[model samples]
Target: MRVYDVEGFPNPARVRIALAEKGAVDDVQFVSVDVMNGEHRSAEYVSKNPDASVPLLELDDGTYLSQCTAITEYIDGTYSGASLCGQSPKERAIIHMMNRRAENGLLDAVGDYFHHATPGLGPTLETNQVADWGKLRKSKAIETMRYLDDTLKSRTYVAGDTFSMADITVFAGLAFADFAKIEIPAELTHLSAWRKKVAARPSINA
Candidate 1:
């Protein structure tokens, strides 16, 4: 499989972490895509992923998987190691719920704020920016972080006790937030604590 992404980007980092956890990092080929240069928007790349997004996975059989969640699910189901997706139906549903919340509320919000409100990746990559919408999303991202903090206060991980894709999404979200200069309020001690634990994991080093 070939995974196309940019290094140091949060979404790609999520896939890298999942691949590391699955012990499949060495099995797949990594191809760097330069978003700053509009490489992702090129026709050649768009043919593989029409969305023009990074962290895309192309299977050996010539099938391309674009979304991070879909790629992560494929890795989790196909490889053997610690499962990032939950094992049971209930666990799966809860994890998926939390994962979507993390993506919409935090990660995607931060990205919107960066691209629209701030000059994210500069003017070359960011077009048609809406300052008002981006500012709104920035505020919403913080609000969601507070909600997540509350959720973390009662559990060892997001979506109950085990580490799952939901946790991965939030971890990547927080990392993206840092890039956007959005800080988790100091009062969110539980979220901070949880972040510390996740950061120390060996897969993070990958």
Candidate 2:
């Protein structure tokens, strides 16, 4: 299998971290997609993913898979050893819920700030019209983080005690936020501690 990725991006980092956790890093080939140069929008890349997204997985049989969550889930299911997802149905549901929350609340918000506010990769992104929308989305994202910080006070991980996909999603999202100069509020002590724990993981730097 081949994985098209971008360095220094959270979406691709998620997949790389997942591969490390699953001990499947050596199993697949990686093709770097340079986001900084607007390479993702090139005609060659557009043919592979019409939406022009990275972290796309192409199977040996020529099947293409898109989206970080779907691709990561497929990896976890197909490898089947040290599972990053929950073993039980209830656990899986909780993990999925937390993952969705992280994506919608944190990741999407960070994307808004990057694509709409910042002049990402120069002319590749439109920074003129979406500035206000980006600010609004950023405020919403921070509010969601505050709520998540409160929820995390009682639980060791996002979903429960185990290190599942939710934890990975949240960690990756928060890391992206950090890169964008967004800091976790001081009031979110639990979240800060959790972030530290995730950061200390060896695979996170992978």
Candidate 3:
């Protein structure tokens, strides 16, 4: 399998981290996508992913997969070394729920704010359409962070005691926010500590 990746990007980093957690980093081929030069918008890339996003996975059988969440789940399900998703139905549901909360509540909001509020990049992003909504979205993201910080005060990871897919999603989302100049609030002590833990992992730098 081959992974089309981009450095300094959140989505690709998520997959890379998952691969690292599963100890499958060296198993797959890596191809860099030059987002700086608008390579993802080219005809060749468009053919692979009509949405023109990075972090696309190409299977040996010629099947292509997009979206970081879906790609990471595929990797975790296929690899047996470490179970990043979960082992039981209840665990799976909890992890999925937390992952969705992080993605929809924080990650998507951060992306919207970055694309609409920040200058440069996001040329095709609907700046006008999201201009008014950017502030609201950013606020929502902060609220989610506060909730996560509070909930995580007594837990080690997002989904409970184990580091699961929910942790991966939250880590990636927060990492993305870092590049956008968004800083975690000082009150979110639990989340701040969790961020350091995830960052210290070897896979995160991969």
Q: Evaluated with lDDT, which candidate comes out highest?
A: 1
Q: What is the TM-score (0 to 1) of candidate 1? A: 0.98
The parts of candidate 3 lying over 4 Å away from their true place are: 120-129
lDDT of each: 0.93, 0.84, 0.85
Per-residue alpha-carbon lDDT of candidate 3 for residues 1-206, written as tens digits (9 for 90 to 100): 99998866878888888998888989999999987778898999999998799899999999999988789889998888768888899998998899999998888888887777776375653436566577777887889899899989989999999998789889988987887778889989999999898789887777
lDDT per residue for candidate 1 within 23-112, as digits (tens), equals: 889999999998888999999999999999989999999999999999999999999877788899999999999999999999999999
- Total clashes for model 3: 0
RMSD of candidate 3 to true structure, Å: 1.7
Best by TM-score: 1
lDDT of 1 at 9: 96
Ranking of candidates on TM-score, top first: 1, 2, 3
Candidate 1 Cα outliers beyond 4 Å, as residue runs: none
C-alpha positional error of residue 168 in candidate 2 after TM-score superposition, expressed in Å: 1.4
Query: What's model 1's overall lDDT?
Result: 0.93
lDDT at 170, model 3: 91
Where in model 2 is the C-alpha error above 4 Å?
none
